[model samples]
Target: MTTPPFPAPTTAELAVVSAQLGRTARGVVGIAARCECGNPTVVATTPRLPDGTPFPTFYYLTHPAATAAMSTLEATQVMPELSALLAEDDGVAAAYLAAHEAYLADRAQFGEVSEIDGISAGGMPSRVKCLHALAGHALAAGPGVNPIGDAALERSTWSPEKCRCDDPGAALRDVEASTA
Candidate 1:
């Protein structure tokens, strides 16, 4: 049996993530990866949301700068280039397929969602679809797990090594304390 990626998110973390996404995060199971400054960079979302929606993208990227960088890459014709590389490179294709399996395995640890049982994000196992999803997976699973995600991160300008959050830790803490 596969283990869940995390226990649960703190209220502060959920608040920060909600702020990052500009919406109350629905299925967040845990903070999958964090920035150098401790803010969430990637979130581990459950396969099924609290409201019963089937959420396929397990590792959801939340950092604004990181998401923007992936968006920039997606906007700049990088998908086709990566798709071409995925087509030509046997190693990459194989690794990408493995990554897809890993993704499904991770989500399966939480619960089975029949709607997304075989679905992994970023058009995984076959084609490149969303850089944000791929990058999120790379950040959560780390390097060498997802070749396409690693490639996307390498092509993008965002770095998890730095903090680009508008307010970072203090604001999130302050808000939580106020609510408490």
Candidate 2:
């Protein structure tokens, strides 16, 4: 009997697997930090498992200073929008609004308090990178419709091309064509 050929892994599959392995390895390293108050700081490295599954593990330590800072940041950046969204009547709209609000909150909180410990893409800190990753996951996993027409707003409203139509009917035709 002939042996069946194994299927090659796709780029996305390889990425997920690699990420899972990295997270597992980091977990095994027991990543932890020390706080000024003689307390152990929580050092969590959330890595996805193969097939894009999130690891059910989180490293926990008590860093009162870090926890306090994180709490203050969350209250300032994430609470108001969440409050507004909670008051909204439309479930879908509320969810979308909340997601954007949460993204903004995380961005603000992490951007202000976290420092980039090592070299990163776009000169952003590892915390900010992690926030971005979380935001991406939230966007992909959340049950909300993305609003359209936002990308179009980024470009210039008018083009510099000249129009050459003297007749009223021709101008109307041009308008119709352009509109269409």
Candidate 3:
């Protein structure tokens, strides 16, 4: 079956979310990048385990430009319309709410894994993997689809065997300082 595309956030919305993410990542082991498409890219490296294994992961936030580009629709038109749809229909609002919940749950799971065991920067489970999984999930869920399933969710999950960093914090600091 052909997979549907995901809904993207507007530039303004992306900026708002990116700023929040920056604040959260500040002083932590991650760096945020603003794409030309107005999307936010978050890179998280992993620390090596006692056994010398690694686990790295990356994340992406839908920017207004990318979102618009993906849907071939104007952000100005889509954002307001989505808002109006949620306001007008309870079912639509519920779907949106469900999607939000699923997104948050997946993010939290990623964060928990990254923090507990750390992630690697030079190997598999890279930021691209995380972002791809997130985007794929969102697209599969689609707009106005309630109670999204968790199938294929674990495909994005990171493991130490896939990483190759000795110190994620140091890598994160290096990236953050260089970007700043």
Candidate 4:
């Protein structure tokens, strides 16, 4: 199995992630990225789940705010816009290919599975499918790793530099409302 770049998940981290996702955290191998308040923002999951299911998404966005921001962008028809860029910009296509390679390398750490081989999320190297997945990879890999993800993040209302979770009470209320 591949080792996650981030630290192993603490029980408390998993709890926070479950709260963030409004579901039990499954196959989470590491906390890929954290909010300014030190809560999980992105989680690195196993390539293959415990049930032997091949899950291609290695980096998953966990923070409600980040997910919401990506959703909003998606609703604005950002996917096609970005997909057009991918079609027209050779540099972007190359970078996206590199991102896809990076994703494959990262997942290879978990062990190579035929079912998910050469498949990277967010329609890498060709199209933009899921901004959340792209953003998750950006957050996990850091800036400059995934260009589309970086672009989406740059256009987002949220920023890692900002401490949006400074107020736990507010964050909890928002999370509760989202889960509800």
> In terms of lDDT, which candidate is strongest?
1
Better of 2 and 3 by lDDT: 3
Q: Which stretches in model 4 have alpha-carbon errors above 4 Å? A: 1-3, 166-180
What is the TM-score of each predicted model, taking all chains together?
0.94, 0.23, 0.31, 0.89
Q: Give the C-alpha miss distance for residue 105 in model 2, angstroms.
A: 26
**Model 4 agreement with the true structure over 1-180: per-residue lDDT tens digits:** 645677788776777788788989889989898887767899988889889999999999988889989999999988888888889999989999999999889978877789988998988867899999999999999899899999999989998767666574455445555566
Superposed model 3: Cα runs more than 4 Å off: 1-72, 112-137, 140-180
Least accurate stretch of 10 residues (summed lDDT) in model 2? 147-156
**Model 2 lDDT per residue over 1-180, tens place:** 221112233333223223323432332222233223212233333333335444322222223233343344344554343334334536534444544444333233222222322222111211111222222223222324211111111121211122111231333234345556
Quality of model 4 by C-alpha lDDT: 0.86
Q: Rate the local accuracy (lDDT) of all candidates.
A: 0.90, 0.29, 0.34, 0.86
lDDT of 1 by residue, 72-180 (tens): 9989999999999999999999999999999988888889988887999999999999999999999999999999999999988988887777766665677678779
- For 1-180, candidate 3 gives per-residue lDDT tens digits of 222122333334333444544443211123233332322333322233234443323233323333323233222243344345456777655654655554434334334453534332111121112223233334334323322212122222322223322333343344455556
Ranking by lDDT: 1, 4, 3, 2
Candidate 2 lDDT at 24 equals 22
The TM-score of candidate 3 is 0.31
Q: For model 1, how many clashes?
A: 0
Which residue segments of model 1 deviate by more than 4 Å?
none
